[model samples]
Target chain A: MSTWNMITFQDSNSLYSDNLISFHDFIMLFIIMIISLTLFFIVDLMLNKFMNLLLLKNHMIEIIWTLIPMFILMMICYPSLKILYFIDEMFNPYFSIKAIGHQWYWSYEYPEFNNYEINCYMNNYMNKNQFRLLETDNRLIIPFKISLRLLVSSVDVIHSWTIQSLGIKVDAVPGRINQLNLFSIRPGLFFGQCSEICGINHSFMPIMLESTSYFNFINWMNNNNN
Target chain B: MVKYTQLGNATTLETPADLKPKTAPYDPRFPNQNQTRYCYTSYLDFHRCKKRHSEEYEACKYFKKVYTAMCPLAWTTNWDEQIENGNFPGDI
Candidate 1:
């Protein structure tokens, strides 16, 4: 029996994969961090060193400092805008999942699979011996190496479906369906939870996704067929 | 809430007086009764069990017992795995 403190390592074939958008986002963050850190020290040192060298009564230095930040902001915004447009440009999706958020849980439907649907709720016990809230009764399994489209929405209130490994987070708003794309490079289990506060059991709406090879996925789907 | 006795088992809620059926010999194995059922606690706990076991049906009885021991809302589990796999004698 596994002890409470022992962490179960993930299987060898993991699901994580690199994507262009995430790489760009990381680069942008890195640039912003470097600029902020350097500017912070530079500004502090300059303020002390040149306190009396520059004009004391004029406010031009403050204006220059303000415009410099605005210029940096433009540099950050342009790339972010371009990436948003790129992600929004759609193409043919291999498979789609309809996730409907409810009061205390989430329900998912696969229209291709005879409209099969299942409700998922969270189990929050943290005794490593027990499954934590990260696990769900019926995981939304998908095939690896294929782009999967997710249609997210809500039935009662607003919620957000977010998975850190996939780097995808979208709002589940009532009366609106938002779509996102995901493709795992390999086979493994990915866990997520409700990122938005909807109701009393907002913390209970956990999501579990299992990705497998195309052949294994088809076999698993056939086995789970109604 | 009024309690009802069916097959020597006392239920939490009473049966509707107008819909009462004729009394018959009490069977310990299967007790047929009409009563208000509480399902919330049972459903959530069974859901917890499915997550822990990844939908393995052999542990349904053990999970059901755990659910009942915890609270009255232990009725939400569909027990589909056990029904799909079929229950066998001496199976836990």
Candidate 2:
């Protein structure tokens, strides 16, 4: 994320993040409507001089108010639940990568290729174009346009594997492996960090993923293997 | 190891039919977000399955695959050492 997206969500790189952003906008529309409607009512209460002398309570208004909220809730519930299930749907993965979290670094492994490992530590030295704390020594390279699986675990303490652009966040808990689906729509560099604080250097354990084509990924694998 | 033929000549990659990566199937017994019990139980079940049947038994290999995918290599490596020493906590 650059300075532009620091206050908001980063540029979406997957369908999950796109759906999440739309859902956020959908909820925000209701929030703004509710606030404005309440403001109008408050203004009406303060300025109105007319009073209904014969009316104690109106049944029509009460029913309308109750049913309107129910309708609105149903509208919100449908898409919210749909996106939740959609994100959880794990398609057949083209590649499966395992990520193990340690005290201040994240080590990744390609389980298919004889456990090809890449230990990613924080990169203190950075160029002007790179992010300061978000840079890492190794980037977890993946193939875009193909659905992949990410298995997350912690070696010692609990950590969180997160990438906001893809809307993927899985808790790296010790003694267990949690999996997530990863499908980037485009080729780019996505950055994240260990959201769950394991120790003092938890802030230093950053994650960087470089998305490329499948052909390039295979070449990278061959080169690393050799 | 899985390899692709489109190394340098082709722009697109066609994965072979047998290149699908496999992971542990979901078990309903441990149906929570945390999978610690799932990994531990799978490890115990694999050893127990080995004790009941031969190592080459097809069904015994299923539990081994689950434990291998879900648990860290260090845990299984140490557990193998304990099994050789006959100091493993859980009964086979």
Candidate 3:
């Protein structure tokens, strides 16, 4: 967990989140703030001038103001649309995992490798170094730098499978599977919790993912098979 | 409130003792002593047991009971080293 003074996002672990934070910074600091400050100064100067009544009625000013805003919007829209399409693009993922949200806990299923499944429960007791509510009994492990597809659904009620650092949040709704693409740029531990209000133990259901090297993941798969 | 028996017969409301399992002492080794806590703690123990003892994981009676319904084979064997180092999370 990051302190309140931390203005920026947690160092992005995945490409999706990194792009998202950069786009946000560009829009907020570069585009919107600069335009607003420029407009504020111009409007203040116009208000101080004595003969602004005649100039206010000028048709050229109206057209310029409207067109400038439209142009700015076009600039914002281009990247927004590009990112949207980029996120929606489903390249052939190396493997797929199904995350099923129960009343509280999350059950993960690896359909690609013999349909292996694990029910991740919250760790009520914690060690000195472990996070209080963010730790789980089992950590979902994946290989870094690989595109993976996550299919999310719910068994009891609606729960969102969200990881802030990974920039992935998909609703786990009953009877409907929502697919999301995950591509980690590096290997590290990322934590997230169920973002939906499901029941009494909703806050306890946390997600912990361990992104490891490709070689380590292969070794894990081999060792576990026996 | 409506009161009904197991056979759907109308009857006076009665608290069933079987509904609630008593809490027992907490033991890291055999955390599943209480049936109610067992339902919750078994999930943690199954993963912990297999990770600590991969080859003889099936010999763990509690892990075997949980393996029957809760955990899959490949998932259990992956954490053998983590359990040995006391890095696996949970009370057990």
lDDT of 3 by residue, B4-82 (tens): 1111121222322332311111235432211223323565666557658773655455544433222223334544466
Real contacts recovered, all predictions: 0.00, 0.16, 0.00
At residue B43, candidate 2 shows an lDDT of 88
Q: Can you tell me the CAPRI class of model 2?
A: incorrect
- Identify the superior model by lDDT, candidate 1 or candidate 3: 3
For residues A19-60, could you state the per-residue lDDT of candidate 2 as single tens digits?
777777777889899999999999998999988889998999
Provide the TM-score of the second chain in candidate 2: 0.73
Residue range with the least summed lDDT across 10 consecutive positions in model 3 chain A: A49-58
Cα lDDT over the full model 3: 0.66
What tens-digit string does per-residue lDDT give for candidate 1 at A183-215? 565678777789998888788788888887767
- What residue pairs clash in candidate 3, if any at all? B51-B79, B51-B80
lDDT of 3 by residue, A1-226 (tens): 4445988787777656756777776577556676798999899888885554555477887899899878878776776676666665554456667788988899887755556678899997647787888889988888776767676777789998988898888887765556667667778888899999999988999998889987788688777666
Query: Candidate 1, which segments miss by more than 4 Å at Cα?
Result: A1-71, A124-127, B1-92
Give the per-residue lDDT digits (tens) of candidate 2, residues B2-84: 11121111113344555565666656785454556766788899888888887788987888776766666667788999999
Lowest-sum lDDT 10-residue window in model 2 chain A: A86-95
